[model samples]
Each structure stands twice: as structure tokens, then as C-alpha cells.
Target: MIKAIGGYFGLEMSRAESLRYPDAQYFQSARACFYALLIQGKPSKVWLPYYNCDAMLGPLQRMGIDYGFYAIDEDFTISRALRLAPTEWLVYVNYFGLCDRQQAEVLRRFNPAQVVLDHAQAYYSPPVDCLATLYSPRKFFGVPDGGILVSNVRVGSTAADEEASHQRMSHLLKRFATSAEAGYADFQAAEKSLEAFDVSEMSQLSRNLLACADTPTVIEQRNHNFLTLHARLAEHNALAFDPSTLNGPLCYPFLNERNDAVRPDLLGESVYVARYWAECQGRCSPASWEYKLSRLLLPLPCDHRYTDADVQRVITLIEKGLKGD
Candidate 1:
């Protein structure tokens, strides 16, 4: 019954913290923006996180940009002291919307030209003033496909033709009447479709959905749900980040060793937790923290559309996993 009624919705409730981007270009994916920026900058060397997706690195690799990796500390800050030359570029992920104001501000200390803030996990976190910020709207909402990039560098191009997004929305659609599990292939295919796509403007359908979103309500709800879940699970959770730190967190990113046992229970309850990135497996060694984090982290949904009761349900389910039941 749980999977029948509740599983019809997204793995997480799709909500936009806001639709207000004053001057921005919408693309099919964040990678499209990265491609445009790399093309325009023509940087010789690129810096990125060791724990990252191949789609992100694909652009740099294709351009033959001399690339280097940066490491993240336990809390996912820039643990490694890394630097770039005057004409090089750097890209960083603000994991789980937990990057502090100071950490974000430090990027601005560099030439704004060299900094690309990947807010794929953060929607409500304010864009570090005058820095290039990349947002994946699909990650935050029920939209089929779209990415927004706000930057000083402009690539001379308009929205290119795009594959119809309706095909990509099957999971979101099927979940309403069936199980989210049934539509998994549709979701995976939708994501794979974005990789081959180059620079393009946001689709009309995506733009319209974004325009109609109640973003403020979504942000407020996300904050409340995250804090509530954090307060309950913080003692057992191994991550060092604070719950008060989230603006509009993508999810309650609780990292723990027990995730392998807990996930199936949550699935049985129709409570789906996202594996932040499976690509971490193929990219890093088995002993690497990034790889372990990929396998163990539970990105539990604490977005809008869930109430306190729902929060408690998820907590109860998680506790069951901790006990190895």
C-alpha cells in the first residue's frame, strides 16, 4: 500500500526553492554550460574534484585540457591545498548545500574568471556574489531536463534544438499511478540523454514549469524537514556537518556505514534514498573515501511535500536498519 500510494511521486518531492534568476542562460545540462565556459575561456589546465561524475570531466577531456583533481575533507570542504595558474580554471561542488558562507566566499578571492561554483546540490544557497554558478533544475524539481548557468563569460549561441523532454518524465509520471521502481529505466535514460547534448537554451516546457513553481514555500519546507530529520538522526550519523547550515538542502545527506542494510527497508516503505553518485565507484578506488561515501551515503528526501509524520516514518525505518533487522 505504501508503494502503491506514495511511490507514485518522485524519489524525493520535486520542489524549486526559487525561479528568480535575473540574468541567466538555461541549458540542457550543467555540462553544456561547462562546455561553453571551457570553450570561451580556452583554459590550458582545469581543476576539479576527485569525487566527480564523468559527464563533468568529459568536456575537459574532449578539449584535451590538462586537468588535475582536488580532494575533499570529511565534511566535503576543499581539504587539499590546490592552486591554479593565472589563465587556468577551477570547478568545485558545494556538496549537499552544506558549503559554508566562508568556504564559498574563499572562491571569490580568486579571479572570478577562474571559479565555477557547482550548486547542483544547492538551490536556495545564495550565489556567491559575482561568481559563475551552475544549477541543475531537474535535480531540484519535477522538470524533465534543464540546467541554468549564471556567469560573466558569454558564449555566442542561442538555444539549440532539444529532444522532447516528455520521454524523460516517465518516472515522475508513472510514480503517480505505479511504483517508482517500475520507472527507473526511464529516469536513467533521461540522464544519459543529457550527456550527448551540447549547449542549448532551456526547453519551453521546463521554463514554463519553473515559472509557475512556488519556490519560497519549497525552500522553507526543505529547511524544516532537513533540520527535523537531522535532529533525530544526528547522534547516529557520522557526518560532521550541521543541520542549521542548510538553506535549501537537496536532501538529508546522512553518511553512515549502515546504509547498505538500511536502503532496502526504506525502499520497502516507499521511502527512496538517492545514491548521490554511482560514478564514484568507477572513478575512485574501493578504499577511497569518495568510493565508500558513494556506497554508504543515504541522500534521504527531506524536501517539501513531506510532513513531520513522514519524517518520523523515515527515522523509524532507518533505526530498523541500524539494528540489522
Candidate 2:
């Protein structure tokens, strides 16, 4: 395939070593990775959480695999008693990366071979000994789409490589050039484009962009920002846990009634707080913990993009908003 030595240059990206999970399988999306695993393993039935987005059930529904919903306690622990047959599996989401200890505890009760670890929110949390552990790198990085699967299941067939991610780069470029609000519509559209994805290998563009990430700095910044938020807002936060325990959390999930009340106002101040799952109401009862979390929980930004001062700004705005100012 080597023909010309040099002619015109393309988009230049860092060749620096990026975060690498050497022992995992890569796919186009977390759903694609899950689909690949299911296509090969062919589990007859699976159990999922009611708190989850409908996207998680795509693979199972596509294959006509039967599944049941389970409930979780306030602490994110499975609340129901479960018994599984030989051909069944359970999928547990590492909610907001704060439930590592709980995840480890849950894995003990089930056969390690029948449990699937959904680390979509827990990217920094390493994969443990399990049947199949799935990670959505796009959730944590700037890459368009990528999924990592660390599993005991053997690969039966290889999916074709994904098409270039240039089309998906519109929102990213738009946001980078201007403001998040300016590109909000493009971002939503880009996300919707992946809704009907099939199993495929990770795109080369995404892989290269992933290689440019500053892993150590990103982890440190996330931890620092999260702790900063927890320090100021822990009293208002309803969810009780040691804030310093998590490695690199997705965000500082400040589960306070005040936080939820001020969420809409914060966006007016250029602080966009995301709801945990807006669509969970259809699948979850109003009295359920998940439904309450959906409405009450505020996932404040504590990622690597902001500084300590930026965090302080958010804290002050939240405090002001809570006072009805």
C-alpha cells in the first residue's frame, strides 16, 4: 500500500502515549462491545437495573434475549433477591464511579462468570475479574466513540473497522471554536446518530485522539475538582460516602434537593449541570430510588477541564442559587 512518500499533510494529532488498557477488546461503542459479547456468548436471559437508560437494553432486545428489571437501594446496591439459571447473566452499572466498593461486594454474591460489569461511568476504575467488563471511553474523553471490553469470553468473530469519525467531529469542533451552548444542538444530533449502531471495531480517528490524552493529569484534576466540590457541599448532599475514596470520578454527584432546585438557574450562569437520566421515569416508578435520583441528583462538572477557581465559582453560584438570590 506504500506509494508516495509525502504530498499533503492531514490533521495533526499528538503521537504521545495515551491511556491504554492492554488486555481489553476495543469496539465502536459500549453498546457495540456489549453486542459483540452477546452475539458470541448468546446468553438466554439477563437482568438489568431499572435506573438505566433504554440504550443498555439494545443488544438484548435486538437478539430477542429475554431480560428482567431489578431495583437498587439508595446506596446503589441490588435490593431484590435474585436467582439465575445456567444460561443467565446480570448487568451491574458502576453508577457515577462512586460505587467501586459496592460493585466489588455485589460481584461476590453472583457467579463471576454470570456477571457483567458496566463501567460506563467508571472509566478510571480498572476492570476486575468478571465475565465481561464494559467501558465507554467516549464518556470520559474527547474521542467520538469507543468501547473497551475486558472479558473472559473468547472472541468468535471480528467486526469490521468503523468508518472515520469526521462526521461526528462537528459538535466537538463547534464547541471548541465557540461555546458549549453554541454547539449544544450539534452535540445532541451527534449523540442521536449512534443510537442505531452495530458492532464494529474502534475508529482510527478516535483511537488516535485517545492517544493524545494526558491520562495522569486528567485523573488528578478530576479527583481534585470532585473533592473541592464535596468539601463545600457535603452537608447539603444527601448521598453519604467518603469523597476521597474514588480514583477519578465521573463527577461530584451532589445529591441535594437544593442542587436539583438550582440546576436550571446554574445553566443561566454558564454552569450546565446534567441530569443523571431524564428518561428513567418511564421505566421506574415515582417512588423508586432511581426515579428520585433522576429528578433530585445534580451531576456537577468536576472533570479535567476546570480549575480550582472554576470549582469555587460553581460552589458560590450554587450557594447563591440555594438562597433564592
Candidate 3:
């Protein structure tokens, strides 16, 4: 599974991790706060990455918030956009678990009051000091609906309602029965009725999973799986690491000059690989488009669910595929 899926992926444990409950469902609230802040005193402009989720842009659009796009260099850092304009609000992403402390420092120099750290990808080693930090638990852990937003700023109090709670519990029960697809369907159904302003319930199952998560073990497995993939794929002269000063890589991104030709061959072997971000939806830019097209990011499963053998199988398949044997 590690070989197939890739990245520090894992099945969340049942008991033993910390539980944040109402506070855990912070992403929505943070969005709400941003909206409220804009209404009270709309900033001149906000900045975000061209490569990002459409869901994030929804709130900004609804709030009538104006925004701009920044460029990600070959190193995946925002070095050039710092001097673009006097940014009022900046959304900083910890892309693929690579720490962006230096990027954050640059943003801080411009306007510390307007920076929002989107740690949705770097949940494992999230930053502590930031004006605000938002995370989606579902991406990293097995959760139905929960996100954590931590900040010193005060926002309105609108707790998760009963319907959302029931729906979340239903999803949990369905997931526990090993029907993940069914659970996901149910979640989608619930999302349809959710109001833009309403707060959704945090999944207890997700909280429990986080509390029971083995941090040290997960980290070790992730690093091991990543290193294995790197060692095996590095010999291919055509494949090279996305040059970035990443302390920890959540996914092993490789630049394949012949991706259009080689991708199908790899997939034919039942090695499911992703061509992540084939299309940039939100705020598309020339630099982002160029950066995205030249790369294929592979996630190595380093989560507790994967073992050493899983990593080996993935590498073996890659080696065979590369040889066309």
C-alpha cells in the first residue's frame, strides 16, 4: 500500500491522542472570522498561491474579498512575489510538508498583521508561531468533517449544531463498518444542506484517531519510506528531486521530462500514480502553470498502516516499469 499510494499516510488509531472537540472544527470559524474582518475593515488585497483548493477560494469570493496570486519558484518558495505589492493579507501554505519558515519571515517583514498560515499539508510538523493557522484533519487522518484553526484573534461563537453532529456520527459508524465509500457518500449528502454560515460538527472518531496517533513512529516510517523511494528513483537521470530546502517531505515530488510518455507505462503495471494538479482552477498564473506541468509528485505511505515490505513492493514495481520488462 505504501508503494502504491505513497507519502506519510496512515490509519488513525482509536484511543490515546488529544481531543480538541468544538475547538477542532476551527477552519470554518477561521473563514468566518476572515469574512467578518473583511466586512468590518476590508483589507486592500489578499495573496494566495495559484495552486490551491477551490473550497478555500469560496469563502473569499462570498466575502467579496479581493486577492492576488504569488509565484512558487523551482524550490517551491515564494521569493519573487515579496516585492509585487504591499500585501494586506497573505495566505502561506506549507506545501507538501516542507517547512516555509523563511517564506513566513519574508511575509512578516511586509505585514505581520495580515498573514494567515495554511498548514493543511504540514499538519505533522505544523508551525507554532503564526497569526493564525488552519488545518484540515481529513487530509492526514481518517476523519469525516473536522479542521483545526488556532489563533489569538477572537471570532464569533457559533458551535456545531445537532444535524451536523448526527451526520458526522453516521459517517463514523459507517466507516467503522469498513464502508468508507458509503461513509463518504453520506458525508457528501450532508454537505449539500450545509449553509455557508453554519458550523459543522467535528468528528469524534477523527479526534479519537488524532489522540491515538503515534507521532514518533509515524514520522520514522514516513522518513524511511521517502528515503527508500528517493534512493530507488534517483538513479534515473531523467528524474530529479524538486529542488527545495524541505526539512521533511510529505510527498516525494519528481520532475519527469517525459511524463506524458512514461506515466502511462507506470500506470499499466497497476502502480497507481497521480498527476496532481493537472489543472489550476482558482488564480492561475504563468509561473504556477509551468511549475505544476514539469512535475509529478508521488506520495510514499509512511503512516503506521504501511510496513517495510509495502515500500519494497512499490520500488520493485517502479524498477520493472522503468525497464519495460
TM-score of each: 0.87, 0.94, 0.74
CA lDDT for candidate 2: 0.84
Q: lDDT of model 1 at residue 150?
A: 87
Task: Order the candidate numbers by TM-score, best to worst.
Answer: 2, 1, 3
Choose the strongest candidate by TM-score: 2
lDDT winner among the candidates? 2
| Model 3: per-residue Cα lDDT at residue 143 | 52
The segments of candidate 3 whose C-alpha lies over 4 angstroms from its true place after superposition are 1-14, 20-42, 84-87, 101-109, 162-201, 236-249, 261-275, 281-295
Candidate 3, run of 10 with poorest lDDT: 21-30
Over 1-325, each residue of candidate 1 has an lDDT whose tens digit, in order, gives 4546643553343435345686787887788877877778788888788787777888888788888887776767665477779878778888877785645555655676687888888876767654478888787877777878888767744664545676677777876678778878888887887788677777866776777678668889999998888888998888866656767888888887888989989888889787767886776778888888888989889988789999999999998899897
Give the residue spans of candidate 1 off by over 4 A: 1-18, 160-163, 177-179, 283-285
Clashing pairs counted in every model: 3, 0, 10
The lDDT of each candidate is: 0.78, 0.84, 0.57
Candidate 2 per-residue C-alpha lDDT over 1-325 given as tens digits, one digit per residue, 9 for 90 to 100: 7787899987777766754787788888898888988898889899998888788788898999999988999888987587778899999999888899888887888898999999999998988998999999888887777888899786543554455466778788878888888888878887887787687777778888888878888889999999899889888888887765868889888877666569878888889877778888888889888899998888888999999899999999888877888
lDDT of 3 by residue, 48-137 (tens): 776665556666787677877776655556656355354477777776675565455555565555677776666665545545667665
